[model samples]
Target chain A: MFERVLIVEDHESVSNSVKQALNDLGVDNPEHVSYCDYALSWIKKAIVTPQPYDLLITDLSFEEDQTVQQITDGVALIRAVREVQPDLKILVFTAEGRLEVIRPLIEKLGINAYVRKARRDTQELKAAFEAIANGRNYFPLQMKRSERNGHSFNFSTYDITIIRLLAEGKKQKDIPQCLQDNKITPSSLSSLEKRLNQIKDEFSFTTNEQLIAYCKDFKII
Target chain B: MFERVLIVEDHESVSNSVKQALNDLGVDNPEHVSYCDYALSWIKKAIVTPQPYDLLITDLSFEEDQTVQQITDGVALIRAVREVQPDLKILVFTAEGRLEVIRPLIEKLGINAYVRKARRDTQELKAAFEAIANGRNYFPLQMKRSERNGHSFNFSTYDITIIRLLAEGKKQKDIPQCLQDNKITPSSLSSLEKRLNQIKDEFSFTTNEQLIAYCKDFKII
Candidate 1:
């Protein structure tokens, strides 16, 4: 019954297509914000607005420097919106499929629905909207079978500590000192940097700077 | 507030302790079932009886044997229960921290709550029970940050093929031939074994056989 929808996505073409699709679904007053700040402003005004968006479809990734806070990623954006409007339904649309990466926020942030961005089918989003519209839930079906089976990743908590430090603009050589300062020296972090490099390669990046910049931009730091 | 809880956990001590903790929280009927079958039986019986258990606190690792149709290892259990009693609250007590692994179920399954197992405090189980009692959600606060930044480890279609061939007791030399036969070459599999070894070490295993055995046991194969 909720017709108004708001979308928080960085991809302009994709966002427009989704907006048009919702229009086809008879949803009017659908607003698309390309960044979290704009979406937050809309949500802040939603309390007094005559017509507040009933549904939200957001993407996890955002354009760099467009995000305000170091932690103001799309997931963070969703968390903020949840605080403002606990009753509003949200559906996440993302292409990132790492089961290990987003495991914790699924429950922690109180997301209403999730749709993996599929190139072949719009049915995933369609199904998600239908489920939430009926006051039911929608998520991937294979999660129960896969469970936590492959959810573990190579980077330990120490790696995150180092990555966060690096994102703070510390030098590559100073990383070892940083790890030592934090009292988390499993190995001399020259070795840790080596490990970090390995992680970056796994995700397909060549250098520490690129990885650090990527993490900072994504607010992983 | 509902008191009776069914615990579907594979680990013996964890299963026992969780039940004990629930009992300590003043829930008299905290039923604990280790295998998925036992858990399923209780769910089925509860459906017919109507005086069903109020909650399911499941470990994400429980898998039915190789032959059984893997309906819902962990999520399926909750789904099965929800199929019968759509309102029953479920709390996932898990070590899994991946987006793909956790996102779909939390959004789709209508899980009442979750408590990250690794961050289990001295009174964490009691806290989880109490949260459920109050009709509120309880997921760990810190889990979201680490889980988001964590690199998602996905075994590629090629990775799956290699692991499967390894599981079938094929020797190391057979991998290149196997890949060649399949019209794909993964360069040298010597490094493949090294990566597999690293994976095995992370998951706590000794040999390829041990890794294969774990796969069989965990239903990852």
Candidate 2:
């Protein structure tokens, strides 16, 4: 029953659907903007007014356009908005499925709900809205399952650093120099070899190529 | 309006939305399946019956589960269905936004229409159905624009081959041996160096790393 809602999304179709969902939920005339900057300004302007938006529904990636924008994406916009309105209920509606990308949003940004823009999204959106209205956080079931499975093999920053270097086409021998340059500890050849071997064993990967491919496929790198 | 519609999507929310859209369009009792194998069986069985599904609405990716499936993904399912029912209209309803992945479904598979699973997708799905029912093709507006912009810099097979190797951490000089093993012409170190330089110059990339990163970002390699 959140009456005042603001939508930040680039796609007209998506925004239209969100509006329709809000209307169906008895939340009338929810305001919407295609750009993050405009969304910010509206939120800022509404803060001084008697009527303020209590909820924000946003998409993560916005298609780049002719207009130059300081706040180009939803993550930045969310961060900025949190500074101004600390108590606003925020929901992310996006097509992004990567756990690596989404984990930080919930852990760091403290979003109230995340409903992926997929089939039966209207239902999902409504469910998320209901949860948020009742002061409960809503996360998709699949994400929870992924989190449980993903916890089995934890990827440390050091692991990501080495894997990212390998993905960037650096050979095993060349990684030590890059790591040393970055002032990362234990940059010796033997240490790097040991770490790579340990990681590969954990993942049951035979070679660096498989490990790199797996990382890329999972968006870990 | 198309009467008999078969929706092949793993996510219950998405399938429900598609059903809702189809119901709104006056197409009642549309069959739904969570697996591609089941979808194919349904289609195959219906083919012998008086009423076969006229349209196949499917998503590209399916969550892997305990059930073993021969036609694991939608692309394989599409290809399999094409063999049995060539005239049945196929509309790809997927979250995939990559031009490379979508282009093939249009050009090679000759799918009747494509509706991305996004905000306002119900509207788009209906619109796509209408177009396909009228014997026309439907491609998203952004996709058409991307096609126009994408035509400028074509990534040939040779370009992709070299870039993929580079992404796998192959050095420039080391590429000659890989090319030679594959019996690819111009396997000499000088030829590879020349090709790499030429491609970088076309894209205005100062280094191979930039070229590799660009290819990865755009899913060219």
Candidate 3:
């Protein structure tokens, strides 16, 4: 059902293979580019065209080149493109399989799918495309568990603000004053202590430092 | 003081620039290669030669190619080279700047220095080489603090073995029995508890989970 797609990959062999796979999946004229700058330009071009690209499949890391570039990595490119077209469906293709590293991108960027580059990954890629076309998010089963657990526990604005401040090296005693200055609700020292303790208990964390590290790993802060 | 050094980097531009930097530092005959396999073979040749390479500089990630390789990443190459030449000094030059990732290479593999690939990194690389030549280990100042704190506390065999088991997903209650079966000393329940508590207190950790994560970050286990 997909009409248009754009692939951003630095490796020539990888880009060609991905293009071939897209062809076999019945998507014709699937455009590809090796640089983030060119990919951005293509996205911009599609925005004013009669029929815009429906999906963007991109690699995360790009090798360096002689020509200077404003966008060096895919994350920065995603941020830039999102500013121009917020509703574009995105699928990330990367060799980086670390959950902690990629979780923040999915949560913050609202990317539609992530397909790891591995053996039999082409099948996984096709499945991801179909899922995205059906308006559903797709992640590997192992990562699905982490995604569910990450989202199951809801974090309030107050919790996020407190964690962010803690990560910035703010002292517990000084946090109440900082929160009050920002007009954050329930800024009392006792209230803050209770909230932190509750969060620690929920996560089975025994100390504030552990809570901070856990929040960092999950990209909650 | 360095006579011969080998550079292992995949990117031609990066390899050339690093080679230029080495030349500037008055180190002639500085050889460079784009693959880990070539680097390993060169090390083996040097090992049998009358004059062996005095230092090794390697990047962690190499771009994947159509031609499959026996040794793909730099870490595996480091391990292989270390096995053959235990006394060889190694300097890791990588874009991977995270302390959690690089700390293990320093503590477990005994790498001489780590230089992040960033602005003015050529100067940093030169400094790393000089420091290693002077019989000193060089890590960024931020990492130096953690390294000092990590080394300040002494870990006994009992402490390490317990933490290693815990990291392997062993429950606290099940640990004493496991250790006893292995004929480890201080296998009493009370002694195990005391040792764990002492370790936690030393690191200001409040739970066994926190202790395990901390040990993992510092590569203590």
Candidate 4:
């Protein structure tokens, strides 16, 4: 059980719920703040005190309000907190489903756990807390299962370049020229077409439009 | 308290949590199923029996698996269930945040309550259950505040058409021609520009790209 915890979330109901969940988990009287700047300041002041907060539960998106903030969202808050207290355990509880939005938090931020604000989140929260307590990193179960089932593809730099161009509303014929301008190898129109086809085939997509949409949804481009 | 409740959620962990929440709320031994079709069948069977399910708790999205379901998602299930058992109280528990996706459930389907699966959702769930039990429709608190604050814009069909075109990678300069082809009123480029600007100003977005992204994120298009 965590002795001290801080929650960063804008929604009052959500924050209250988090506090209740934490209390149920034996974390008594956890502190909460609505703004990221306030959370950062609290963390900064606490680190110099005799007892520091052990865990941070934060939501990724914060509704914009009248108060101007240097650290506006959860990602920025997490980064700032990491700089000040690198060893503090962080658990992200958010409704954001895009892989592009979530992948960086785990890989780059070195977060202890990632819990989606979805059905049965309390159970997941308890599981995440236990994992962190035992020095293990907890990720969403769906992501792990999908990765294991080969649903997550390894896109090459060339593949990503082509997909990104398409996402930017570039015509198929215009891609080869852009690739040639960038000095990427095998920049011919035929090679580009073949590569696109190969990538689509790997994902069982019938059209380039579907491939582009999938890439965007997954945040690959 | 709901004496007879049925939970339709795909995720095992989420379903278990929902069951636990129901149990805590004094609904003992609530029935649950992973697929929408199975849930529909269960409801159909239950309705014929002496005791009918009084409340239905469902998740909006179900991950695609080997099970080929006629009613795949929660929305469709709700619609189907409504047709068969019009009096059954329905409570949607999902992580979907887009207003575009959620508006229809409330406005068209006439769902009893909507609880977003986020932080402190159990509390919301209890509130929703109580509301439905008392014959009052319950919406997410954040949505209620946003609506009261005038943050929810009422976009007309014309607005959606323009935003959808932009989302489909259509160029701004080429939009007028598409509008003319479809015989939409005031298909002039200047009117298009004026309307686009008005929308941006309403949301304080400086660029068309930002507007497009906002619309997409909120599922407006």
Candidate 5:
């Protein structure tokens, strides 16, 4: 179980409820911050010290106050925090219910759990904590539905770069030269072809255009 | 035609090529900057002056240097520029080819044109300028193909909010009350149902879950 947790949320009521939830889940010594900047500073300091936070529970959006914040949003905060502490488990608690927004937080950003702010969000928070404590990534029911529909593919940065190039109107044969010029590794034709074919097979796509279309539709590239 | 254009690109070669392309298009006086902060400062200055730049052409990503920049990326720059000069047209010239990433810039961020930096990118740049000059939003061929596949939708902020709430685990019956609590307008159940139906019909979605799944997959929400 996570003995120490840090909650980053702007709403006072929500933050209090999260603390109560964590208390009920038997996790004590949970700290909270109202601003992303403050939270980030705390995390950075914790990183330098021996007792770093066991888990970071953060909200994606924060209400802008009069003072200008260095890190305005949770995405930037997460990226910065990840850079400092790569192994830290992150559980995002946000009112932003869009999968388009949160998918990257999970897939690309490597968040451990996501608990949406809704009617029974406290319950979900508890579940999220339990899941994270057990070293499992918790996906809400909606995200599970996305996975069932084949929208959940483990995409490497290498794969994304290749697909993005293709979408930029690069022909298959010419990709090697483009990659070589860009100094991207595995620029050989055989590797490119094999990788593209593998992606096509995974998605049941017939052509590069279709693959591009699918990627665009899903915002994959 | 735009007489004055501001180009924001970190790459020296790409910036030079873009300048040449603009010159070839018979549009002289295209100013270039390597840093987003410098580009934003120029834009801010132009806003108060009489001879404001007609169009802004920017790359999405900027290389980080030794000195920390206030406006680190092109998205932040575009947002700041849009706030100051709402009428100034924006044409994104970037190697970023992911529709998922750039679609928001077109639909939400209000960028007028996109020119992918690939083979014959200079030609595309000229075409983008021509489209913008003619008061048309230039959709790259890949983007056009996405629209053909029914990926394009005119999603209002309200619609996105509603769908996002649903994706966040809010029941249809509970949404109106939740929205009402948040002081959001059109909080009646009938309106919410009608809006959801319209969106489902637009995407041929049989259920709210499917709609959410589609939104997640396409990064629409």
Candidate 6:
């Protein structure tokens, strides 16, 4: 069990429900901070005495809309808390499902675990806690980035144009004309097709057709 | 074509091959660095001026294995670069395919693109560049954190036990006794069933029987 847990969330209902859930699961001494400044105060207090929480459960969004500190976002707050104690275990239990939010926190904040609020059931939280305590990492659900934007993975700008043109039903020969107008040569076009096929294989898709469809469905366009 | 490119690769042959590819594509102003210090030097220079490169292509591992600089690792490098220049385009062009590597990088680094070197085809790089320029992000192929560990997505620790026991043909009533003896309780069991249903929706398994097969195929036991 986490010796000292701090909950940094703005939603009173979700925070209270979490407290109740922890009690039901037999976790006591869990502290709660509903705002970033208060959390900062806690961080300052923890620095000298190391009241630095053993495990920090935080929602990614603490935007405080209509409040004074509306500019402070989730990633910035996480970084502030991190500056005080670099070794803290942070479990981002938030609703922000975008990789733009999730990935940067993982990269910048040194997050120990990721739990999506919408998809995760009760026991998954316990699993996340246990894993973080034991020095393992966890990511509950990942909605791929490309799907949201229908973008191709590791693709060049020309490749994007080609994919779009291809999706619009242009012939491969017609693609070279579009490319030649844009400075790509016939040899470059051949190399491009071969490489696109290879990238397609890495994604486990049968053809460029399947890849484009998956990308579009995910909104990676 | 990229006006000024920065390459953060360790291997000479691979870097040169990629450089050749870039040259073939008419991008000739690439600044190549096999070490972190040199890369950081270029980074400082880029910040001082506009940039030596418009895009940065980096590998996760570096040669000489620079000591104590966060720039030694690809994730750390992305973080540092992002801290200094929040909008620099970073394309991870590497072979580090693990989710622990890929997921965190995607989550934290805010990397604009990813292309596994071993998996690269001529067209994929082109595609990645195009996507990034058009303000899109890319991830190397995604692997669920649970799947890599041979665990079922919906199964908590008790669910795993129950699944294993069921797979071994244990009776339903006997299962509760088995769990009870092991400190797993009723609410946990209910939550487990609830979670299974959620996963059922996610993977379109439709039936409990199919869920069991999925668990088996994933080697949950």
Q: Which number leads on TM-score?
A: 2
* Candidate 3 segments exceeding 4 Å error: A1-4, A9-38, A49-54, A59-89, A94-112, A117-119, A129-143, A147-152, B1-221
lDDT of 2 at B185: 77
Model 4 residue B53 lDDT score: 94
TM-score leaderboard ranking? 2, 4, 3, 1, 5, 6
Model 1: per-residue Cα lDDT at residue A161: 77
Candidate 5 local lDDT, residue A219 = 59
Q: Per lDDT, what order, best first? A: 2, 4, 3, 5, 1, 6
lDDT top scorer: 2
* CA lDDT, candidate 6, residue A107: 81
Residue A208 miss distance in model 1 (angstroms): 13
C-alpha lDDT score of every prediction, in listed order: 0.66, 0.82, 0.78, 0.80, 0.78, 0.64
Of the candidates shown, which would achieve the greatest DockQ relative to the real structure? 2
Looking at model 3 chain A, which ten-residue stretch has the lowest summed lDDT?
A144-153
Write one digit per residue (lDDT tens) for candidate 6, span B124-197: 66668777767787653434432455323445675676656654545444566677777876635565577656
How does residue A192 of candidate 6 score in lDDT?
Answer: 65
Between prediction 1 and prediction 2, the one with superior DockQ is 2
Report the candidate with higher TM-score, 3 versus 4.
Answer: 4
DockQ for every prediction shown? 0.01, 0.20, 0.06, 0.11, 0.02, 0.01
Error of 4 at B37 (Å): 3.4
- Cα lDDT tens digits for candidate 3, B1-221: 78989999875435655676777788997898878999999999999998998899999988676557799998999999999998899999887755656878998899999987654467788889889989998887855544544446778877888876765546667778998899998888789899888887886765665565555555565
Each model's Cα RMSD = 19.8, 5.4, 11.0, 7.8, 22.0, 27.2
For the predicted complex of model 4, DockQ is 0.11
Question: Which of the CAPRI classes, incorrect, acceptable, medium or high, describes model 4?
Answer: incorrect
Q: Give the higher-TM-score candidate: 2 or 6.
A: 2
| Candidate 1 positional error at B60, Å | 37
As for model 4, its CA RMSD to the true structure in angstroms is 7.8
